[model samples]
Target chain A: MGEGMIQDQSDEDLMKAVAKANQSAFRTLVNRHMGRANTIAMRSLPRREDAEEAVQDSFCKIWVNAASFDPDKAKFMTWFVRILTNTCLDKIRSNPPRAGDIDALADVLADDAASYDAQYGQKREGEAIRKAVQTLPDRQRMAVILCYFEEMTNPQAAEVLGINVKALEGLLVRARRDLKGRLGAGEDNDG
Target chain B: MTDDDLKKRLRAWTVPAPDSGLADRIVMNALRHPQKMPWSLRLGKTLETWLLDWNAGAIYKCASLAMIVVIGLSIGYSSPYAGGADTISIVDLAMGGMNEWEGS
Candidate 1:
């Protein structure tokens, strides 16, 4: 199929073509989802390099395991998110974040600072939110990242986390509560 | 903060966009490493995970080892006598095929 034609196919269909080792279909899928995958990885991981590696590894896995994917069980993005999230979690476990490591989110803020000089207050608020997020327990951090940052639904986030919806809700509630307390304290200190 | 406010604040922590070359790099990496895992290996991983979950990993390993030993022994014993004919007669070789060796 032509590149444009391949691009038009759904992710699930593209996966089928990928199962046959069709490079065009695989490339299309990669181009379509790489940014989202990177964002998810960046949120979960502390370092930019690690996040990039995790995204690469996750896509490689998708290519390798395309034949095993069952669209009936879940949408392609859902399956992909499960793989991406697990990859990130495994990376986190092996090399737990160090206190002094430069965070990828900070880099984002710094880049924003240069481009949007007028949004100084927003930049600081963003920094505070990032710090508060990093302080959350791993699962809770992930819950907030997926639901709030990525905008996944409760069921979708729960599926990615391998928990029931109720459990996922509990995580989000506790996570938000913790963030409220931390961010509020930051504000109080600033004032 | 209210839930809506918290959500809004969370959005402020935007991730940096992925680098322009990321897709090309990932595609190139996949091309270079053309081989993905075979289904058998994936199935093995799934089985291993299941076994570990139930804390039966040690038992699974022992069972696998025992099976290997049993299969090896069975194959060794079965192949030697499978033809039902003596390929090498030790007594004949010793006697040099002499039925009556009435030596001096």
Candidate 2:
């Protein structure tokens, strides 16, 4: 198939082709989802290099397990998020963050802020938030990343975490309460 | 911080866009490992589960062994020379293809 046609194919269809060991289809899938995967990893992990490594590992896993994926059980993004999230968690546990890892996450924020001029106070606030986020427990931090940072719906986030909506809501409530204590007052009823 | 305030704060913490060559690197690394076909994966899973199943009674074990033996015999009997004109009996081979054993 032409590149355009392959690009136009649905993720499930592309996954089916990937199951047959089609490199083009795999490339297409990777290009389509790489940014989101990177974003999730960056939000979850402490260092940029670790986040990138986690993302790479996750995509490699997706390729290796493409045959076992069943779309009927879950959507492609949901499954991908699950894999990416777990990969990040495993990376974190295997190599716990060093003392100055907070600087690394702040450095990523600083790099992002560099594009805008004279946003010094904003940059500081961003760094504070980033550090506070990193201090959260693994699951709570994930809940914050998916719901608050990524703006994913509660049900979708719950599905990605393999939990029911009620349990996810509990996580979000606790996350927000903890963040409130760490950074100041905050009440988010949507969670 | 209110809900909107927290959301704004969270949004301020931005992740840099991945480098231009990131996707290429990931694709190259992943392609080094070939994926298994769906059928083969299923077969592997089935065999793994069967091998790991330790709850079978003696009857099941006997039945499995009998089935294997039957399959082996069937494959042996289906060979090209099993009943062909070239077939040779054990006695004939022992006597060097003679009708009876030669006296030594």
The TM-score leader among the candidates is 1
- Over A94-165, each residue of candidate 1 has an lDDT whose tens digit, in order, gives 999888554545665667676676676777777788789887888998999899988999999999899999
Where does candidate 2 chain B have its weakest 10-residue lDDT segment? B83-92
TM-score of 2: 0.73
- Tell me the deviation in Å of residue B76 in model 2: 18
lDDT of 2 by residue, B1-104 (tens): 67777777688776679989999999999999877556877788777766787653557878999999999989878986465535356555656846444543
Error of 1 at B72 (Å): 28
Determine the TM-score of chain B of model 2.
0.36
* Docking level of model 1: acceptable
User: In order, what DockQ does each candidate have?
Assistant: 0.35, 0.45
Best-fitting candidate, scored by DockQ: 2
Error of 2 at A70 (Å): 0.9
lDDT score at residue A22, model 1, on the 0-100 scale: 92
Q: Second chain only: TM-score per model?
A: 0.33, 0.36
